[model samples]
Target: MPSCQPLNRMKKVLTAQAEAEKIRRIGEAEAGSIEAIGKAEAEKMRLKAEAYQHYGEAAKTALVLEALPKIAGKVAAPLAQTSEIVILSRDGSRVTGEVNRLLAELPVSVNALTGVDLMKIPFLQKMTNPQA
Candidate 1:
């Protein structure tokens, strides 16, 4: 019975060691998952930059065109809730002018905010005038 006591104590110690190793492995897996997520995000950004460099201004212009509809929808979203919009001016030109003004200002506002004038960019300049 005394010899059995030592054997039982040794089994308990081994079991405890195994549990500690399992917990450490789980923690390492969770840490690895977090690191993998960060790496994936960085990879996505790198691909986007590579695409921009490869496609140049044409790609930028295409992206702008694709975004225009979404941007227009957002810009006009406020009017969606309006029950009625009363134009004080008798002339119909006021409504046309307002719509035109909003459309015209969209590009200007985007340029001002982003500080990226596509026209002035070297890629765009080269694209517009091949001789340059």
Candidate 2:
């Protein structure tokens, strides 16, 4: 019976050691997955940063140009909801022309807000003035 007790104790010790080794392996695997995820995220950010650096102001201008109509729509959204409007003017005035003028002013507004002068962009300059 005394010898049997020692064998049982040995078996318990081996079981505990096996459990500890399993836990260590799981911890190491979890750490490796976390490291891989971190590396992938870092790589994604690095690529994005490089792309932004490469695109530079051209991307900004394109984004602004793309967004201009949306911005104008937002600015004029309240007016769109109006059922009717009465304007009294001594001179002949057209609301349509006023709306067009307001839309035209968006680039200037964008320039003021973002400090990215749409007029300065070569493509925009070419668009505005073909001779220049």
Off by over 4 Å in 2: 1-3, 61-132
TM-score of 2: 0.48
For residue 70, model 2's alpha carbon misses the true position, in angstroms, by: 13
TM-scores, all candidates, are 0.56, 0.48
lDDT of 2 by residue, 44-116 (tens): 9999888877887778788778887898789889998899998876665676678779867866888898778
Residue range with the least summed lDDT across 10 consecutive positions in model 2: 88-97
What's the lDDT for residue 98 in model 1? 95
The digit string of per-residue lDDT tens for model 1 on 1-132 reads 357888899999999999999999999999999999999999999999887888866567667767767987998899999999767888889889998897656657767755446566567568656877
Taking all chains together, the TM-score of candidate 1 against the true structure is 0.56
Candidate lDDT values, in order: 0.79, 0.85
